[model samples]
Target: MAYISYLDLPKHWGLERGDRVLLTSDIMQLMFTTMRNGERFDRDAFLDAILGVIGEEGTLLIPTFNWDFCHGVAFDYHKTPCKTGALGGFALSRPDFRRTQHPLYSFAVAGKDQQLLCDMQNVSSFGVDSPFGYLEKNHGKNVIIGIHYTDCFTFVHHCEEVCGVDTYRFSKTFTGQYIDAEGQESTRSYSMLVRSYELYEATDLTLIGEKMERAGVAHVIVLNEIPYRIVDLTAAAPVICDDIKNNSSRGICKHKLQ
Candidate 1:
């Protein structure tokens, strides 16, 4: 039986020292491979390895977004679970982690930038103050594990907002009860730049992901049969924004309106 060491993650995942990264992972897929050879995957150990690579100066963020508030259920920052996956929910329980208050697209952050991220309570999910916006402002890296680009490349929405691509999205408000970290409950309204899911067919984004890879802004790697991508938001956003602004069909939206 072979053993896996947390120390090996930096080289295996192409993680750099002092890097700020937003991690999005499919834990089930990662566990299937990493837990093989009579070994088990330790969530805490894995997180520690990631932190070790980034060091004291770096920041780590995990998306703990849930859309329950949009469905009329109250959003309790302490109670609402992340629909995204296991890692995000796990991060939320850590004493050192700080959770943002965006309701629909909140993030749980650890490391030096935790307080800065915690202060970002954007009323709109994709607006300038959202986590997506903050990531671009900080020139952070996006690490995606065992998931397709279409499912996790939320920065595209930030690019859309930067480019003012409002043709595909509209501002919609959801009002509901919200409980803050201190247990203060209040009725509030939050806005979302919702895509016209019913009127438009989903565009395949694999092509753009490939394009970013070729452009050198995104690095693609496959380890133990699970695919991963690391992209620099500072470099990739401009290219993506240009593609969206120039091309009528950038492979992410329906060419014809319904």
Candidate 2:
């Protein structure tokens, strides 16, 4: 009775072509439940679907937020289960491969153990360790198939204005492993920062568009609005729509085009 099985996603997302895509369980649940009222897609099933769509070379980009994984005492730890938030399930479950920390931006990526192809971070006045950073790394390679979301990229914008930090810093902790400076077995942290997300929509899109251009990503698909089939990010074109009758006052139900 999972949402993925219940909803006709293969048809809706135009998966017939078998394109590569990046999706989170949170986004899958939201898209399925909002589009249909049946069983939801479980975590395993959703992951399977993404793998099936992307194939071997196709990459599935996911964000592992530093706030969720960090146990350090410097920041406020929410301690909520990974699946509770928007991208919580994917962020929590994936393996920690690469991490970067700074005063403003901080995040990590689930490693190859979790089957991630590309992972990177950025540091800015705003939190730069973001999904967008992931997008930038693989930009112009047509390396990205899809950028799915449960919640829009809103936190990145909020963190910069509120946190007032310069670099977003992150690290992966070792439980049992140890290493020494003289090429001996030891444990340490790996960190870096690529860029930041300022509070400018146009600037943000411009960067996103340039990355998408490099990656050969022709479409930026979103599930919420239904006015246009596709949008050209570079042109800043508006999605044109036809006027429809509002019959809520009457008993006549109408099916509107999305």
Candidate 3:
């Protein structure tokens, strides 16, 4: 097998030097193809490939969200593990990664803008002060690997919050034990723009992801049988938001169950 190294990343993903990227992935599937027999996947090498392409001036943000916090579980920023998947957990374990304190939706950051993301204080999960908002502000790309958008296109929800598309979501507050950056414990309340279950039917955001791909801001690549998508959130958000606003028939919100 011809191995793809860290040096091959930029060309494959069309990543620019020093570009900041928010990565959402399930490394397991990719590993199935990329890893050789009887050897554990080297997460460090995968991370290095990404970090190498982004270079010193770039930043990498990985979702470390834990929904249990929304249901009254305490969130210790220093110890609470991300339920997202292997890649997320690996990112969290890195000493350089700093996680934001949002109970339901949090992000772990490394590289140039770690402090900026760690300082986010958005009470609302997708509010302007959240990590999603920060990614947009920095003109970052949202890269999804070995998973479909329906599984984790979180940035879309941020755009919905920004557009005030409240037809299918309601604001709710959760109180939990939170540990701040300084390791101080405090009882805190945070808001989440939760979907109204009665109004939702498990819609697939992959269709919207496909739409973005057609529009040129989203790119898809297949390597060793694993699929990867790279989307410019700054460009894709407006298109998605408008689709939500004007086309109720084809809207992301679903009214029927699958």
Clashing pairs in 1: none
Each model's lDDT comes to 0.81, 0.32, 0.78
Residues 158-252, candidate 1: write the lDDT tens digits: 77777776666767899999999999999999997787765556867787787788889898877666677899988888778877877743745
Q: Which ten residues in a row have the lowest lDDT in candidate 1?
A: 1-10
Off by over 4 Å in 1: 1-7, 255-258
Candidate 2 Cα errors over 4 Å, as ranges:
1-11, 14-20, 24-37, 66-87, 94-134, 137-151, 154-258
lDDT of model 1 at position 28: 90
What does candidate 2's lDDT look like per residue over 101-201, in tens digits?
22123333332212332323232313233443333333311212224211333222322222332333223232222222133443333333223333111
lDDT preference between candidates 2 and 3, better one: 3
How many residue pairs in model 3 have overlapping backbones?
Answer: 0
* Candidates sorted on TM-score, descending: 1, 3, 2
In terms of TM-score, which candidate is strongest?
1
Q: What TM-score would each prediction reach against the true structure?
A: 0.93, 0.39, 0.92
Model 3: lDDT equals 0.78
